[model samples]
Target: MRTGPRAAAVVCGAVALTASLVAGGAGTARAASCNVTTGPYQRQVEQFLGRPVDGRQSAADCEAIKGFQAKHGITPTAGYAGPLTWQTMSVMLAQRAAGTTPNKDGKCPTTVGRIACVDLTRQLSWVQDGATLAYGPVPVRTGKAGTETRTGHRQIYYRSIDHWSTIYDVAMPYAQFFDGGIAFHSVDKSMWNPPGSGGCVNMRPADAKAYWNLLRKGDDVYVYGRKPGT
Candidate 1:
């Protein structure tokens, strides 16, 4: 993902992809893929971000937003829909629509592909393959009533194993591209499935582990609220 905002408000490059093996293990081979059309989650993601769900926002695209936010010292709040966040989100959507993944950060990993959609409003997660939507309800802890989760597109730019928590070792990154240091990650059983986090997405032990397994360093993760069309 490219750091710093662009002078103009145009979108960024295409969705570029490269083949690479993760550090600890090899990932599953790519299956015959198809175009992912708009779905319930897609619509919700857009609505949460206060945008339209017209099949935009890819995994790589979201990751770029996170990268930009991280570079600028923005809190990883996992919610971005303001001007700065929109600036990056629009650029990434354009890049994905073009089917070219521009290499802004040459050092960043490009193995992980883009996410089809996320429905923060519904507290659900889905992985798309073509028109088929494979989804499940993911328990998350959003910001308090006053500190509601930001609504917008984002990506997973970081991950950690064996965190300080004794329950979960996996942590999925979802920082607000230009908000706060809040993020979503796997947590201990005691804190899973409850709206009690400091301002991060919390998941059950098993669910977090499963999500961690499927995620990579640069995966897109979107979050929003329970709004119409969201």
Candidate 2:
């Protein structure tokens, strides 16, 4: 089928219909059979996808599923939570629940105090306080190449509630400066459409503020891997 926004919408509609059909037989048995064996995983799926936990694969759920599938590298983008999608989501959910530790080679630095573990490869970043996850692995836009974001150990050295760049002349709100010029700040969410950052970590406004509240001066920022599309 033709792909892009229109195709995605069509797929979502089809998935919603499929889910509704799977929920029921014909007429009299509809309400009774509507509940699929989605179980706790279904709830997790709904919550993870930011859909209402209504115990059904809703239209919203279907679209969100498609988005989740694309983000996590799931195949087909069919908008259905089949075995593969469920399994993949389960593994990721488990990881998020438990928090991420570096692999054997130590791509992430293990720390006892508060630290921000950024997985540049996956475009996800989270904050942990001595193994306790304080924030998120939410979607982030790191620097593009040439202005390549320097990896390895760093810390939040300064912050500004509303910072204006004299050099770039752009607003860098909720800015927490790390690595000299690089900062963990909020920019337009639409910027992720093309995903370019000037060696700074750009997040959504709410996420940036949340990070500001969670982190303070001198907190560790552990950046790892290379930005995938950069």
Candidate 3:
């Protein structure tokens, strides 16, 4: 989609929640009905094209779909309902429906095994497993207007027992970072939305604990300025 500032922000959070599905080879299943109909996939295509996908196909639609497929390793073919095309479409739809977003920038590292890319725009993060784009929403606090969270490639450099007051009850050590003090820690249940913290990303206590258990001390965590493309 032609991601605007607002969309980009929403996508980032969604990625955090759906990242696991994208990473778990779930998108390979049969395409959901929503994908083929004028549902989430249509919405995404409309957004990406900056217009609607009428009965007549536009060159833009073809190109956009092709690009999307190519990125996900789908053969860039003519129709939009092939295995690869449908799978790609399914991931996009599922991500959005689940509150996940797409990343347009190719900045997040795809090479790191089990690494994930958080698209601040989509409010989602995704973990890759082969061609799948599993994703989920993860609440985070970006830097304030003047001190926005640094965008681009970064990693989980450390884990900390100490955390800011906002997420003190998370029960797990904060997943420390190479990017300032912005760590992935469990958040107080009350503060799960955007612009809620002093620029730190937040996750539900349960989700945070789950991640803490899954992640090790030095796994790669990429935070993107925009959502990473499927």
Candidate 4:
């Protein structure tokens, strides 16, 4: 993910990929047979994945990169150290830099009793109690291009632990509806998947479950920033 505001967004160029791998590790069968190709972000990805930072793709490097791409739902896993793969690494680094004080910038109001803050730019969400950090800075998938998640202040008006989307006919476990059909919910898919959610904030199952337990009906939900590609 590019850092800074949308106006000054920077796209990192990554190196080329030799082959395409599947979404899951099922493609592990061909890991050894992957052709070697170097990407611009090869060195960075290697460093991020704790592989040898030679800025070149090796059999081992291909396997490692493919595994990460698979886990994060980066399509055509392909063992390529491409922009998307590097962006995912960037997001992880940013999250690590956030540490516990996800509200350090105070973009999320501290005045609210207990607020769930969504930073769409960073694809991260966290809960705060007054000035105290209650949870997260966890990865999330927000609205995609056309169906961008609505911003501004809102509150949890309803919740359903075993909710299934009546509109999409998909399971949304631990759903906490804050804005009409949009909710904070758990998706079975990877949080890093591109094109994002259907105007809802999609979380990992564990994070959603934790939010369900920590938050209540009246909790504030503040969403801000523009999701990339929106």
Best by TM-score: 4
TM-score of each: 0.38, 0.55, 0.45, 0.81
Q: Can you write out model 4's per-residue Cα lDDT over 86-175, one digit (the tens) per residue? A: 877887787788888887888989896899999998889999889988887899988777768899999998877876433233456787
lDDT against the true structure, each candidate: 0.37, 0.61, 0.46, 0.74
What does candidate 2's lDDT look like per residue over 1-230, in tens digits?
55432332332233223323422332222222222234445666787677788767766676676676555444445456665566555545544653444333455655648888776665677887765666765767676666667788888887787766443334667877677667787764432323245577778888989999999989999888876545
Give the range of the ten consecutive residues with the poorest summed lDDT in model 1. 10-19
- lDDT string for model 3 (127-153, tens) is 543234544455443443433555666
* Candidates sorted on TM-score, descending: 4, 2, 3, 1
Model 4 RMSD in Å is 9.2
lDDT string for model 1 (57-109, tens) is: 55533443344443333233223323444433443343344232222222222
Decoy 1 TM-score against native? 0.38
Q: Residue 213 of model 2: what lDDT? A: 93
Instruction: Give stretches of model 3 more than 4 Å off.
Output: 1-95, 98-107, 129-139, 161-173, 190-194, 226-230
Which is the winner by TM-score between candidate 2 and candidate 4?
4
